[model samples]
Every structure is written in structure tokens, then in C-alpha cells.
Target: MKKPLDSEVFSSMLDASISYWRQQGKKGVWIKLPLELSNLVEAATKAGFRYHHAEPDYLMLVRWIPNNTPDVLPANASHRVSIGAFVMNSKREVLVVQEKYGRFSGIGLWKLPTGAVDEGEDICTAATREVKEETGIDTDFVEVLAFRQGHKSFFQKSDLFFICMLQPRSFDIQKQASEIEAAQWMPIDEYAAQPLVGGNELVNLITKVCLARFGGTYNGFSPQLTTSASGKQTFLYFNGHFP
Candidate 1:
């Protein structure tokens, strides 16, 4: 005789199924089961679960666990939110800018075009806008590469770095007079030799990985500091531009 599905057994099966879907990269669970399992479905729903499909034979369920961790911000040194872009060119040369003002000023360092993500602004949007403003080159593709957290700061801070591919024949570049002092293209090996702004180790790691995969020119430069409206300190760095 076949074994019947009990509450404990059903719940365990559901948990395993959810885990399997997540490992496969699905965002949420969508399931269809025999209508005979109505009692089981009711029990699950009563347990803080919800379903999607309308068909009686199929059930869709979602059980969300909230993330209680506080979002990190930069000025708080207690928390920070920053975004970076790796802009590369076809000639194996990356675009880099020299910092004309703030913290690591006048130091010849190379980095991606990056900046603090403003409150209420999407990270990718902020990155694209910052790149255009800093290097006068608009990007065509913005692929998120990695996210990292700083270990030493009293405030929690995170960096969102992206791989931005530039448009062909779009190198008519100019620096923002108020933020960047100079902008130009240089070979990847040469650009890597300069000191990085913001003294970041995470940025360096992202650069190494990108170089190994794409094998193209890298770009961007050290971040410059600017005072926020709330009187907090923030830094901006650009990796490279896509267009």
C-alpha cells in the first residue's frame, strides 16, 4: 500500500521543493497539486502562506521571510550605499579620470566611474547618470558584477559594482569640470599601476576578475569626495564607460 501524505510529511516535501526551486535560480515557488490535497493547502495557507494560480487542481504558494538587517549607508560610516561602473573600450584601453578635488586629490589612481547611490534613486540609473556626467560617455549595457561590504567601518557600507559596456564609436569624452579634473583612455596594464582612490580593496578585486574574463581595456578613476545635503561625506569612483 502507498503511504498517505501527512501534515509533517507534506510540509517537509514543500520545504524541499522550495529549496530546489531556489537553487535552480527561480525567484519564487509556483506549484500545481491534485485537488485532493485541499486540506493540506488550507493548512499551509493558514500558516502564513499564500498562493497564486486560480485553477483548483494547481496551487501556487509563497512564504516570504523578511530580512531584518538594516540597510547600510556611507556617511553614517555606520552604513553606506555606493555604485560603480566598469567601462571598457575595444582597443584594450580603459577610460580613467583623475580626481581634481576631495580626499585622495591629485593622486594618479584608476577606478571605475562610481558614486554614492542617492536616496530614492535606483542604483543602475544613478550609475548611468554618473558615468555620463563624469566622462561624457553614455553606456549601452549595465551588468551588475558584484556587491561587497566594508569590514573596518563603524557604519555598515556596501558597494554595488557593475560591468558597463560602451557603445562603438562613442569615445568623444570630456570631464565634468566640477568633479573630475581629467579623463582619458589608457592600456589596462598601465591603468592598473596607479593607486586607487577611496583606498578600496573590493574595487581592485572586481577589476581583476573583469580583466580575466573580458580581456579588454578597462577605465575609470579614483573617487572624489563631496559633501551631501545632510552634511555627510561621500566619495565617487568610476571604473570604465561603455560608450
Candidate 2:
């Protein structure tokens, strides 16, 4: 609100707006309430608004104006996307790091350079960027080898973690000081011998897949740049090598 009005005036204005929207045949109405204007929530609810979603700075409320039609407003994002770079060099060594934080911290588990995908970032770009950021190793995005989906993770939201195969361009390691405790190019065989890898079923499967990819016996989803009907540029990932 530009100026904080008393609940009486705010309710009056809300009623007028709703009437105007109904007259215009609007199907959905959304209102964003700033944190400072929380006192107006009661007025909004009395006018037939319900909670939609919320963020750190604001609360979003919505109302379906057309009673005859179903509410078709899309839901907020329900999944977080992350990536793990399976970067291999010509020396048969995979880039790995010991994070200074998270579950792997202080456990001596050497894992791939991994990070969450930033807003508006593509999966392939996220993999390469994560590798460069954590290990200072430049890499070329190859393909998305595999992905896992898990529910009830990270604030009760589902998560998609993609395993990306990347070919290293520059092998020099300059570990991120704040997040990575140590980083190195470890022999793939030796890296797979770690207790964490040998013990976990999922990790073992991933290791085998990486070996298969290295041996040219496996293929993953490759990104093809394409434009939608709306003329927006985007990547369509699929098995491009298929006949």
C-alpha cells in the first residue's frame, strides 16, 4: 500500500475492486500483501481471498472470481533442482571435492562438485558452473546422465538431482575456500573404492554409469537448442544419438 489506510477504507476499496473485476469478467484475482501491511489480511479474507503462496517479503492471496469455472491458477514451484558434475579428465581421474559443510562434512567423503541450479539457469549450464565454482576446473557440458527425484526434502518440497557428465577443459584445481575443504583429481577407480560409494546402492549405480559413459558404451540426454511456438529460446534434452 502506498499509504496505510484504516481497515474500513481498505475494505471499502477492496469491495469496489472486486466488483469492478467481476464486471470485467476476470477469472482470477491476486493480491500481494507486504509484510508491513499484515494487519490488512483480515479485511482481505472477509472479501473472499485465500492464501496462495508466500515468500520472505510478502504474502500472496488469491480468489477465483468465476464461480462456474474451476480455479486454473497455477501453483507455486514445488521442486528444487540441483546438479552433480561427473567431470572426468583424460588421465582417467574424476574431479572430486570435500565440502566444508552439509552431511558430507568431516566424514572424509569425496563427492562430485555439486550445487543447486540458480533461477533461470539451464541444467547443463548449472553443471558446468558448479564444477568451475567449487573446483575451479573449467568443463564442457556433455549430457545429463541420470536424475533422481525425492520427496519431503528441503522444507518439505520435492527435489530433482541431476547427474551430469562433463569433460574437463582445464584440470588445475583451485578449491572454493569457503565451501570446499579440499579438491583434487582422484583416479576414478580409487574414488569409487571409497566407503560411501561402495556402501550405497545409488552411488554404486552412478559410479557404474559414469564408467559406462567413459567407455563409450552408454548415452545420456543431450541438449538441443530449440524455440517454442512463442519464439522463446530453450533447450530440449533427449537422446540425440538415437537413430
Q: What's the TM-score of each model vs. the native? A: 0.49, 0.89
lDDT (CA) per prediction: 0.61, 0.92
**For residues 130-234, could you state the per-residue lDDT of candidate 1 as single tens digits?**
788899887764345556665444233344334543332478897899988888877887776655622457556776866764653544333445688899767
Error of 2 at 226 (Å): 1.5
How displaced is residue 135 in candidate 2, in Å?
0.7
Task: Please give the distance, in angstroms, between residue 61's alpha carbon in candidate 1 and its true position after superposition.
Answer: 39
Candidate 2 backbone collisions, by pair? none
Q: Could you give me the TM-score of model 1 versus the true structure? A: 0.49
> Which number leads on TM-score?
2
Residue-by-residue lDDT tens digits, candidate 2, 1-243: 645668888999999999999999998989898888888899999999999888888899999998899999888789999998998888899999999988999999999888999999999999999999898888899999999998999988999999999988898899999999999999998999998997899999999998999899999999999999999999999987557
Once fitted onto the true fold, the runs of candidate 2 whose alpha carbons sit more than 4 angstroms away are: 1-4, 19-27, 34-39, 65-72
Instruction: State model 1's lDDT.
Output: 0.61
